[model samples]
Target: MSPPTRRSPRSRPSPEAAEPNGTFDAATRQQIDAVVAALHELYPDADCELAWETPLDLLIATILSAQSTDARVNQVTRDLFSRYRTASDYADADVAELEEEIRSTGFYRQKAKNLIGAGEILRDRFAGEVPRTIDELTEVPGAARKTANVVLGTAYGIPSGFVVDTHVKRLAHRLGLSAETRPEKIESDLMARIPRDEWIFAAHALIWHGRRVCHARRPQCGDCGLADHCPRNGL
Candidate 1:
């Protein structure tokens, strides 16, 4: 009889690589809450890193932040904000010039167009003031649920929903808080687990955690305070 074929150890999956699409049960909820509490303790004063004084500023900055860093967006907005003080200013801005100003952020053409269109909507539809509600804000160009959440929660002190940026998405999966891939679904799962009052704070804390410890390429699991609680998904 032929000897049984042996399987290579490389064929076996590692613990982190064998992560399940986690479920949100009662016990899962408790774990999630504990994770949130731990994150809050770790990052007690987490807040939006974007630099903005007004709702419109935050709205524009969030849009620019799509494929760029907050620091880069702030650098561009430093002069951009001063130049365009109101919706009318952006609405009247020369597209080519605006694109040139923000060219370093990448996808400058689309961003400029979105900014101009957003300004027009704010000027024509909302009377030159950034809308307060999520529905209204999402109607503007480049202001999706994530962007609207940032604007409403950070600028207006209204916790419309959690801001699911790349950081939030990554952390949510790693922490086993949500298994869903889409931001909207992940957000729904989070909303169910996290209290409405902590929605904004939770988002900020998760973002900070992702940036500082749970990095995309190599999460600092050794130093992470939440390592014990984290599933270390996709590690």
Candidate 2:
């Protein structure tokens, strides 16, 4: 898809568009539509950056991604996946050995514990299969709403909710798409404004945009195609 035409500076939202009161009025919703459209144009193929071939791989990678980058998680999983091929493999893994394998991802002890617990849950509850629904997925030790959303949308094509990672959270605030502080609240705001069909794509696009352009610090507003639609909140 071609990028959206850059809006003239004069057409940009006024300072009042920041909407400090946090209301999703007509104008705010319209701006959201524009932002979503621009995101589509900018990242038509955006997807979960984590490398995974199976639902179980994605689930484990998402857990490892907590407090770590996708690149790092992928590096660890390359060797880890080869050794632990199934839920039972992880369930039977030695905690110390697993921790050493994923040590580079940080918080290795807890992450290893969570992974083992997740494996046990998957093996016992789901018959060695990853759960499809959010509730069941989240029941796994490390799969929260964000992780579950990633697994559901990316693996099963289920639009359960928006994946509110740090990048999505930052971009949502900067683009004036959500004024909420908490991840769940931010996700709720985005889900309300963004169409269900576009939920998965929108989250991926926002994450890509956040990483590529709209950084948490030193956001490249000048090069942003959505700058006109964005209110430049907290810039």
Candidate 3:
């Protein structure tokens, strides 16, 4: 009998795709397309779940969303946006009051301080507005890859990198698209596999998939549109 053929790294998806969600090995091309198409069918209009009236809302919400759900972040920011419209608003927010308001989001004390600091930086450095570039966004007190991804992708229409949220990180692994365990490493892997053009929306699609069908605790793989294409189908 012939020995089983071994696939090469070039034959596997890149450690990370590009800025747009493109490029993949043969196995992954169809799989990614199927995942994207399903998202198109189910949501049809993939968008950011964090509620925001302006760039600053999205930025602050992204900061607050750390270790929390977007729904909960939105709940906390329901009127938080109306009251704190600019970076300076957060800069001036009474520390205790800010902590109390954002207390439900978890890690309230840290988040509140970061919010105030980020706002202060934005006001001083960028004139009270969020920056458009990743470098600029990262200058904020609490901004990280995930937060920067949100700000760069949603607020500025810039796709510097994939957003590696809990959903993106998990779905990427389950879909056999990336092998990295850490979020930054996974983002790097994805940047090499996916095309640059689809980066922003691709993250959104995977996020929606992770939430709706590919749940963390119990993914509904049986009903998943990409079941056949999913290597981790039973997950």
> Which residue pairs collide in model 1, if any?
none
**Residue 139 error for model 3, in Å?**
1.0
Candidate 3 lDDT, tens digit per residue, 1-235? Answer: 2211111101222234454545556766766767666667776667688877678878888899998998899878886876787788899999999999999999999999999999899999999888887777787888876788777788778887889888898989888878889887888877767667677878888898888989989999778877877788895
- RMSD of each predicted structure: 14.8, 9.5, 11.1
Could you say which candidate leads in lDDT? 2
- Model 2 scores a C-alpha lDDT of 0.82
lDDT of 2 at 38: 88
Question: Model 2, 7-103: lDDT tens per residue?
Answer: 1001211112222224577886678778888888888788888877778888899999999999898888887877888999999999999999999
**CA lDDT, every model vs. true structure:** 0.81, 0.82, 0.79
Candidate 1 lDDT over 1-235, as tens digits, reads 2211111111211112111223457787678778878988899888888877777778888899989998888788888888888999999999999999999888999999999999999999999999987778888988888888888888878977778889999988888777999887888777767777788888999999989989999988888989878888437
Candidate 2 segments exceeding 4 Å error: 1-26
Can you tell me which runs of candidate 3 are displaced by over 4 Å?
A: 1-27
Question: Candidate 3: deviation at residue 169, Å?
Answer: 1.2
Worst 10 residues of 2 by lDDT: 6-15
TM-score against native, each model: 0.87, 0.88, 0.87
